[model samples]
Target chain A: MSARTYLDAGGRAPLHPRARQAFDAATDEGWADPRRLHAEGRRARLLLDGARESLAGALGCRTEEVHLSAHHTASLHAAVLAISRGRRRIGARVVVSAVERSAVLAAARFVADETPAGRRTAGLPDGVDTVGVDRWGRVDLDRWQEAVSRRGVALAALQHANGEVGTLQPLGEAYGHARAAGVPLVVDAGASVGHVPVQDTWDALAADPADWGGPAGVAVLAVRSRVRAVRAWPEDEDPWFPGGVSVPAALAAAAALQAVLADRERADPDRRALVDLVRSSVARTVPDVEVVGHADDRLPHIVTFSCLYVDGEALLTELDRRGYAVGSGSACTSGTLEPSHVLGAMGTLTHGNVRLVLPRGTVRDDVERFLHDLPEAVAEVRRMIGATGL
Target chain B: MVDARGLACPLPVIRLAAAARAATPGTVVTVWWTDPAARHDVPAWARMRSHTLVGTCPLEQPADRTGPSGPQAWATTVVVEGPPAAPPD
Candidate 1:
């Protein structure tokens, strides 16, 4: 049987060939803990440091600023927890963009639970603030600035680019707003690290290696040295991430990051072209399909669209059956059966949302096949829905 | 008949199971659904319970002539009848 081709990189991107080689080579050696002072531990630590240095160089950050974690989820959680700790004196609230990953949203919700009975917390964290986004998934800077001016916000979290719609946030504007208010900004760069340029306007930034063709588990959280350290629970004074990093995964992640970044300048045009093809094809194929994201400012390899009168989950399955893997907002947010939080925040159609994220080795033929097959799949789904009177 | 037209995954399965229990042997339970996973899920659920799948069809036609959103369009509609055999022991 032939291997399945995955078009849903939003869920997880495939590992790079070089990354796989690094992983295979270090399998036995990466088993040891890096904290131990033994020879094996020292070797593991050296590998981890090398990985960190490579990733840091790609991100245009310092080695000391980058901390590795289990995955993007862990890194984001740790960063959010740290920033919200002991900030009750400033405000019992946290401010986060509505389009953040579920991990960030959950962390904010966790902090919100800790707030002391509604003294006026802004965001998800107790004493934090929450902000909304525009139709293109950009944070409403005017509203955000207004809220910050009124309250002494503790930490502000905004993703560099939305994972679903691929809309690039105004990081420079957001960072300036937060810095002017003396609040630290935590930027989630998970969707746009090597594929797109990393914006350096935030106090701290978090990225996943897998997004850039790296290994899945390794994530980088970059913290400026001068920022006040906010530690997550478990009360580890040393560092929040006590689990010693995996040297091989880190090395693989670094290798992937360096490789993608080195080739980004050349690969970007092709990636953008592919995305445009998907965008135009979907628009032409599906009636009332609104392609989400900024046409120019969006990520090169990602495209999202919402189909009216079609269920997102249903569309995904139909596409999958046709050998085209796609992700939907409905599957991503199902507890309430509402559209994607990002789409909701952006005031876009949420019912039939699907995000097509291209992998590094994706070819033109596959895209053509997907485009050719999508309309049929969508029509099949809509027909199944009994969507009448439309 | 259970209407789970706009529901997501697992919910449809859960609802189908609930409806199935209320049905007697040889009862035709029509499930209206929009989830694409239902194409596989409805059949899988029916097979697991030893029910007989009667029919599955799309609700609407596609707007486009070619592409993924083509003529075989529409979400799915599944009809299953309870088995004549004994229920789970």
Candidate 2:
């Protein structure tokens, strides 16, 4: 018999071979601080610059625009703070979609929570304006336009695609409104960059290395030349700021991005078909299961659904015991024991949520095995809850 | 009274539903549960069964219930009126 299928790419993907090689090579030769004036430092600096330039090529931005950071969450918080601070003189309102990543939403809320109502807080945006999303988790474009058009808007945030449901947002419309308002648009491409084509129009973009099979602990924050984004932490205090990016992780990330982009065209359709199969099969086999997100327009490798009678945590545990690894954006899994904000915003069933993200090189057989095991797992969870009949 | 504590998710609601069905008319069924989902699921179940939600409050550890390490902790106490308007089909 073949090996048990591993279907939990949404949690963290297996590292790509090229990324592994690059990271291994970098640790030996590129460990020296790039800011030092020694020969070893020069060698590390060269590797770091090369990685930045390579990532710049992939992202359609200049190497100088890319600032490597610790991770996606930190990068997003820094970017939001910097961009909002840079435009503080113009306004103090930062706007974001309701379905944005928790990092983005939290950053906005942090700033809003710190200050008094209608009062400008130094180094922080005053008020946060949230734009609602449609039932499919797409930002309501009309509401977004209205919020971004407000005279006191300092910055606006919209993700290229939602991480939980895989729904792609209308970034172009959000960007157009931001441009008209003379505000910088920050796009979190953490979920879409390596899997799909990310446009060059957004004023600022954030991406994580783990999204493309690279190692964790590093992310890229790229800002357009025309956009003014000041670093929340100065280089003197934070050595890893601006040009002090981790050489090894950055190099590995660049290699991984190149590898994924090279074979994306060939692998996209195959992976997408597997995802579609899961979406259809789950709905077909699992009673009262609601598949969330756009039917046609979504990330090629991600599918999410909510089972009505199952407990999210129990169902996750059952799948794990059956040798299938999956993740949930549900409240029970989120440590808060509340429903998924993405599902809640869409007015969809938030309980028993399951998200499946296929990693690169996933075969149809593996996906098929997962599909075969899922209904049984759901049924087992329901039975445990004394909900066997339903 | 149903002590559904230490159980996760739909179990609490299922037990509550059963208790609500078994209780006589005008009697109140109090369900002590640990799972947070009961905050919403229990209320929804009551409304669906056409029972009145007497109230819901934070529950403290029961005086008689002691754990091996210490006293047990359960967070939610959901109260519902008994005798469903319609059969629990």
Candidate 3:
């Protein structure tokens, strides 16, 4: 266990120490239903409101604009569906980057398919429009403009950064186009909220607690008051999220965000350097490997690469045997029949993929050791599948 | 012709490369690949091996529909460019 290296903290991190402490305390003070008029409920509500304010301060939004959801995907689903419903008088067309998370894409498609059958075009799908991306996994701004500016377009959603490839999108430019079209833009900053400076360029934003070394039960969603978004679910006392979120989880998430923000300026650059080291070493030492995503315009702590003539699962297993934990976006390993939409949309090789997300405070020596073992692991995986000497 | 349909990932390209290795230069190696990775990996493998990815065309089912792992076939053709195989005659 002492020798093991974990680089696969994709959307979840080990709970921050401060977060653990906060969660333990909140478990006691924040356990009430938070809806009753009783004193216990008032205490829970206070804790919940305080957490919301903390997240809002970190996100650069108003406290009222920030709300908590059960998890990250729920926040995105509500953002997509409610925005579509709110703008129902307008056409149902929703524009999303090709590299958006599967949850976002699925929700977009759901609302698109919900459009009246007669309203749909003969060949084209009416509800959603997908904009293609470049080989670097960055969205094509010109194409995005064309899509968003189309008549009757309801809303647009683009992730701040792709978790799989670590490529940061041109959110400033993309958001500008959406604004000019009078279309609200939703930014899924789940991958960038804690690791990078999220621009205030979004009309609505979704963040993941798991992404910030917090407890996984709560997620943050901030919607600008003018996004024309209504609750997607049935009318309830709590419109955004019907059932209240766990107070303890919300408090833990808040504490973790504050702790991460305080240390990020000092810790992020070191993580960036370690990632750069792995990028250079892997490309230099390994043969037929492609280091993917934008070279400079990317998340600091994430690096992804694809190896030719190697199976993604086999390579992952080989690395696991060496006590190195990594991630794969390849279809065989992704648990989905299709490979990563991010890598596929970028026209990159999707097999033999490895995604390394360095958690905060990852030691440099651990990364170096992993780099030392990576080449041999890839070579051995290739050889096992009768792919050697070709 | 090699049928790598239902095989995931590097298997498709690996099989293609293995097939190309036995043929003389300019011999065409055809493969039916279902794994979506072949769309990029086969071309990538061809370029890395100095082989020619001559033709590619989508077959029966388009790969975009997400669900269980099954054959989502696409026919790909690569022409060999390396030296001839060892003769046993």
**Which has the greatest DockQ?**
3
How would you order the candidates by DockQ, starting with the best? 3, 2, 1
- Please tell me how candidate 2 rates in CAPRI terms: incorrect
CAPRI quality level assigned to candidate 1 from its DockQ score: incorrect
Candidate 3 overall Cα lDDT vs. reference? 0.87
Q: Give lDDT tens digits, candidate 2, residues A1-390.
A: 445565667526789899999999999999999878899989998999999999999999999888888888988888888787777667668899998898999988775565445455344345889989887899999999888887777789999998889999988878998898788899999999898899876998998888879888789889888987655566662422554567898999999999999999999999889989998999899876788899888999999998866778888888888877788876677777566777777766666889988888889888888888888888888877777552
Each candidate's DockQ score against the native complex?
0.03, 0.19, 0.53
For every candidate, what is the interface RMSD in angstroms?
A: 12.4, 3.6, 1.5
Sort order, TM-score high to low: 3, 2, 1
Instruction: Encode model 3's per-residue lDDT on A92-153: one tens digit a residue.
Output: 88999999999999999998878877656433335688999998999999999999999878
Worst-scoring 10-residue span by lDDT in model 3 chain A:
A118-127
Which sections of candidate 1 miss by over 4 Å?
A: A1-3, A28-31, A117-128, A235-238, A331-336, B1-89
Q: Kindly report which residue stretches of model 2 are placed more than 4 angstroms away from their true locations once superposed.
A: A1-4, A116-125, A237-243, B1-8, B11-89
Pairs clashing in candidate 3?
Answer: A112-A127
By lDDT, the better pick of 2 and 3 is 3
lDDT, candidate 2, equals: 0.80
**Top-scoring candidate (lDDT):** 3
